[model samples]
Every structure is written in C-alpha cells, then in structure tokens.
Target chain A: MLGLSITQWLFGTLSLMAIMFALMMVFTRSPVNSALYLIMTFFCIAGHYLLLNAQFLAVVQIVVYAGAIMVLFLYIIMLMNLNADEEPRKHVLTRAIAAIIGGMLLFVMIGALRGAEQLQIVQGGASQIGLVKNLGKVLFTEFLFPFEIASVLLLAALVGAIMIGKRDTNINTK
Target chain B: MLNGIPINYYIMLSAVLFIIGAVGVMARRNAIIIFMCIELMLNAVNLMLVAFSTLHNDANGQVFVFFIMAVAAAEVAVGLAILSMVYRNFKSIDIDLLSRLKN
Candidate 1:
C-alpha cells in the first residue's frame, strides 16, 4: 500500500489521466479528436477541484469548460469542416524546438520550487469557504465592482462576436 | 489540508500542464488548435489559483478563478468569431498561410 491513503491514490490517478489526455489532445491530428481529449482533460481537472473541496468551482469547471467552451470548439471545427488530413504539419525542426523550450521551462519551474515542501500552509480547519454561499457573499461585497465589470465584458464580447461573424453585405454591393 | 497532500504536488501538476499547453501553442499551425492550447494554459492557471485558495482558506482566490472563467469565455467568443471570419476570407485557417501581414 506504500502508506498512501485513498485520497493520495485518487490524486495520482487523476493527475496521470489529465496529463495523458492533454498530451493526446496536442498530438492528435484531428481537431474533433483533439477537442474530445481536451474535454477529458477538463473532467480530470474538475476531479482535482473536487479533491480540493472547491465544490462550486468544480461544478463551474465542468459546466463552463467542458460544456460551453468545448461545445463552441466542436461547433467551429464542424462549421469549418477541418479534417485531420487537411491540416499541414509544422516543420520537424519547429516541433523539436518547441519541445525543448517546454522542457526547459519545466526544469526552471521545478528548480524554483525546490524547497516548496517546507513552506508551511496555514490550515483553516474544515473551512466551508468553497461553498457557493460563502463565495457569493465575498463576490458580491468586496469584489462587487469587478463582478459588474465582468458582466459588461461579457456583453461587449457578445456584440463583438456577432459583428465579426456576420457577413459584410457592403462588400458585395461594392 | 486537502487530505494531507502537499501544495507542491498541485503546483507541479499545474506547471506540467501549463508547459504542455505552451508547447502546443508554439508547435501547432492551426489557429483553432492554438486557441485551444491557450485555453489549456488558462485552465492550468485556474487550477493553481483554486489550490492556493483552498490552502489559505480564502474565497478570494476562487472568486478570481470565477472572474478568469468569465474573461476566458468572452475571449473565446470573440476569438472564434475572428477565426471564422479569417477562414471566410482566406479559405484556410493555417497560420503559415496568413503571413500576408508580415510583408
């Protein structure tokens, strides 16, 4: 058993699955397949959120990321009819450089966090802070301004998307 | 304490995920795929934020994650719209072919 509890086991499994799916998402040639793999990765992340007891965020992660965003991705892919064979591969040298860059970044990050385990995290015992009631209270009070701004941002994005996606009738007339 | 798991574990996991996303962004030529990679990077950041939030027992970090999700949604909407328009004009979504602006 290696002295590991069930929670540790779950964490290990979820992390591995998440990494594997993310790799598959990047490596897959088909856009649809890539999207699907990314969805699986999102689910794994949601599981991580639940493990952390961020229940509201866990549900939101699934609803927003896995549900809305990925659906939009699939819709765009289907609309464009992008096929696996049609996508032109990047040069081999470019891919190798990218991999090397990523590896270096990972190495630097790990190096920076060499003593992170010794850093003490103050544990507020059995905190109910992850619940929606607590989060909403904080959100509406201290963060009220940002919350209102986010709404305006969403509105602007909606209008901009419509403007961009609509066919320009004036071009044909000219 | 998240079942006695160290915060470093979450940190490492997110770091790896973020690196994967960064590599995907740099290596892929497809604009849509690049956009997805950006989303992946954002998710990695979100995970880190939530983990820290839990560590400190503060709802503020989770609130930031919520705001991030909002911004990400808006960004995706506008980005995909632009990408679709680009496809309409160029008949392709390959970033290499869209190099007319470089000249």
Candidate 2:
C-alpha cells in the first residue's frame, strides 16, 4: 500500500534537489554553467509535480520548461559566444542591499507558510480524477481564450527572437 | 522513519530558494545571470504552489502552476531577446554598465 508518509519523503528529497540546483544556478559565475544547472533545477520541479499527483503537469513541465525553454537558452548562450569575458563585477553596496532583501523575503515566505498550517485542510485527490482529461476539459470549456492567447504570445516571441537574433548584415556592410 | 516532513518543510525550502534568487537578482551584475535568478524565484514559487496543492488535495494550484510556467517561458524568451539586443549595442551584459540606455 502506498502510504502518505512515504510520498511526503519522496517530495522532500526532490525539493532538496530543486533548492540546491537553484542556488547553484544563481551563485555560479559562468552563465553557461548556470544555464545548465537551471535545466537540472527545472527537472527537479517537474519531479515535484509528479509527487503532487499532477501527472499531466509533470510531463508538461518537463516538456515546456526543461525540454524546450532550456534548449532555447542554451542556443542563445552559445550563439552569442558569451564566455568569461562578458560578465563584470558588481559594487559592494548592491550586493549588501540584495542580501538584506533576500533575507527579508525568506523570513516572509516562511512565516506565511506557518500560517497556512492553521488554515482549513482540503481532503480529496485530484490526481485520482484523470488529470490530463480534466485539465483539457477546463482548458477548452473555461480557459479557452487564455490558452489561445498563450500560443499567440509564444508566436510573437518566436518572431521577435528571430528578428533580434538575425545577423545584422546591414551593420556589417557599413 | 523517513517520512516525518510536513507540507511546511517544502514551503520553507521554497522560501529559501526564492530568497537566494532574490539576492542573485539584486547583487549580480550580469544581466543574463540576473534573469536566470528571476527564473529561480519563479520556480521556487511554483514549488510552493505544487506543495500546497498536494496538501489540500486540490488541483487548482497545480493548474495555476501550469499557467505560471507558460508565462515564465514567454517572459524568458522576450527578456533574453532584450538582453541580446543590449549586448549587441553595448558588447557587455553587465547591468551597471547599461546606464544611459541610449549609450
């Protein structure tokens, strides 16, 4: 029998991976390495979705975030030929302010989460309800327009990227 | 004896991740790295959403996470484009150097 406690442990492990990889992505000096680590972080987040019983979402997260978006990032990073030379050092004051703000955000999120425990608990498994079909139902019936608009935005982004990434022959000629 | 964690644990972890990302954003000079840090914060928020969704046994939060992921994809695409443009003009992705916007 699958126990709730066991499931929680599984999620806890994946969460640890996610957090560590995220920190790596942020703290790394090399943008190329950071981008690759971010891909790992995305995969861990997908694992969390699977733990939550959102099978469709888990797959989608992998497909969209890990698969497509990350490859896009890698492509751009490589295409730009951005190596160690491009990054510059920041001032101490900026770093200090960032640390202070980061500490505050951490405190607030923890406090809010503690408060959530006092709130009423919900009891039911949407995971058991056939996630993919149900999600499609909602997308088509209720969130159809939003779904279409999302595609539209993606389309615009695609065009815009091509436009920007296109080699500037005009400038080269001059 | 390994399953002692509650939903709160996950939430706390997410909070820490978010904070780290925030620090990277404010402190890091590289525009691309700062953007990656923003993505980290967003993923951290997604982690919290999925955790709560699991705790409550509700799929709505998970659904919201899906939307958030979509939006994040869009944002990254556009933002990276802008950054590349900044690079094209300035030759460096340093945030502090892109001061005048026109220059």
Candidate 3:
C-alpha cells in the first residue's frame, strides 16, 4: 500500500452516495422525485467512469444520461399532467404477489451467482492511458459497421415515432 | 487498482446497481420512472464493460460504451416522444393506463 487513504476515502464516499440515491430512486413515490434521484445516480456513475480513467466516457455519461435523457424524462413527466389524487393504488393481493415474485427472483439470482464461474480479476494498478483517442480509433475502425447500423436504426425509429405521434386531421374534418 | 481492489469489485458494484434498477422497474408504475430504471440498468452494463476493458487491457469496451450512449440517446428521444403522445391522448403516463394498445 502506498498509504493513500484519501483515494479510498473518496471512492468509498462516492460509492455510498451512489447507492443511497439508487435506493431512493426505487422507493420514491413521485415519478419526478424518482427521476431526480436517478440523475444523481447517473452523476455518480460518471464519477466512477472518471475513476476508471475513461474521461471521455465520463463526459458522455453526463452529457447523454444526466443532461439529455433526464431532461427528456422531465419533459414527459410534465406533459403527463400527473397528480396525487388520481394515481392508481395497487390492490393488496397484487402487491403481495409482486413481493413474492420479487423474492423468488432474488433467490434465483443468488443461486446463479453462487455457482457462476469466478472471473480471475487481476489485482494492482494499470499502466493504461490515452482514453479518448484510443476509444475513438476503435469505434471508427473496428465498430464502424455496427455504429452506422445503429444510426440507420435510429433514423427509422425516429420516422416511426413521428408517424405514430402525428394527429390525423381527417378524422376531425369528417 | 488502488489498494489491490480487484476488477470483480467494480463488476459486483455494477451488478448490484443493475439489480436495484430492475427492482425499481418492477415496483414503479410510472412510465418515465420505469424508463429511468432502464437507463440505470444500461449505465450499470456500461460500468461493467469499462471494467472488463481494463481487465482484459483493451479499449474496445470504451468504444462499445460510446455506441451504447448513442443508442441510449436515440432511444430516449423516441421513447419520450411516444410517452408524450400517450399522455396527449390518455392524460396519464401510468403503465396500467396504457392499455389502448394492449389489444
């Protein structure tokens, strides 16, 4: 050990904050509050990306998740016109069944994890460097086709979404 | 890497986060919150990808993470638009209320 207590302290505090917000997001009753908590979770994940030396990903994580996607979420929430009075309350039987199903899922996950092959995680510091440029190179060179395909898919999805969202004036005219 | 923290620690942290997100999805009835949980899950996967990249000592994981970010962005745009449409018609974003398309 190099006696860098500050590093571990920082990482541990950040991880704790991330976990807290994640749990809050799950339990928060209001969708808007849940969305806000999820943003906090995204910010902490960006911090993790930075810790892992992926500075570019850290920036993209903020720009994409925290900034863009979260804003979109807030916009939808605003458009939905939700209030405390009208939200449907789940029946007691349904809630009980849900809890049972969730417990079973947890049990399965624990069993699967217990038997899973352990990845031999190498220990110690990495000498790796040059994150952005290297990632860009691989993205453009090796993953070029997949990237282009994703773009095409996005375009198609955009057209489909717009068509679905468009209002039909002919019905009103009739 | 500090104090010999193994790659599994990072992966495990993300895996736990992913499970938390999944539970959120199951418990939440709101569409936007469910979508947020999905994004959380995606971010967790991205965390594991970067960790694995460092483990195998390759930059490909970072590249994949970037592509995922792009796809996620696209998905959010399209998803929010649909949500807004559903809201315009139903005046609500509850998953239970979105039964117009169920048939």
**TM-score for chain A, candidates 1 onward in order:** 0.95, 0.82, 0.79
Kindly report the docking quality category of candidate 2: acceptable
Off by over 4 Å in 2: A1-4, A112-126, A166-174, B1-5, B101-103
lDDT of 2: 0.76
The residue-by-residue lDDT of candidate 3 on A1-174, one tens digit each, is 457455456567678888799989877777778788999999999987777677888898898789988987887676676654565555667656655665676566566666555554333336253277777788788889998998898898789778767886787699
Tens-digit lDDT track of model 1 for B1-103: 3346788988999999999999999999999999999999999999999889888888989999999999999999999999999999999999999888799
Model 3 chain A lDDT-worst window of ten: A121-130
Write candidate 2's Cα lDDT for A1-174 as tens digits: 455666566666787888788878877778899899999988887876676667787888889887887887778778778776656767778778788888887777666666565432222253452288877776777778887888898888788877886778999999
- Please tell me what DockQ candidate 1 reaches: 0.66
Ranking by TM-score: 1, 3, 2
lDDT of 3 at A5: 53
lDDT of each: 0.92, 0.76, 0.76
Of 1 and 3, which scores higher on lDDT?
Answer: 1
DockQ-derived CAPRI band for the predicted complex in model 3: medium
Each candidate's interface RMSD, rounded to one decimal? 2.1, 3.5, 3.0
Please list the residue runs of candidate 3 whose C-alpha ends up more than 4 Å from where it truly belongs after superposition: A1-7, A96-100, A103-130, B100-103
The per-prediction tally of clashing pairs is 0, 0, 0
TM-score, chain A only, candidate 2, equals: 0.82
Off by over 4 Å in 1: A119-125
Model 2 clashing-pair count: 0
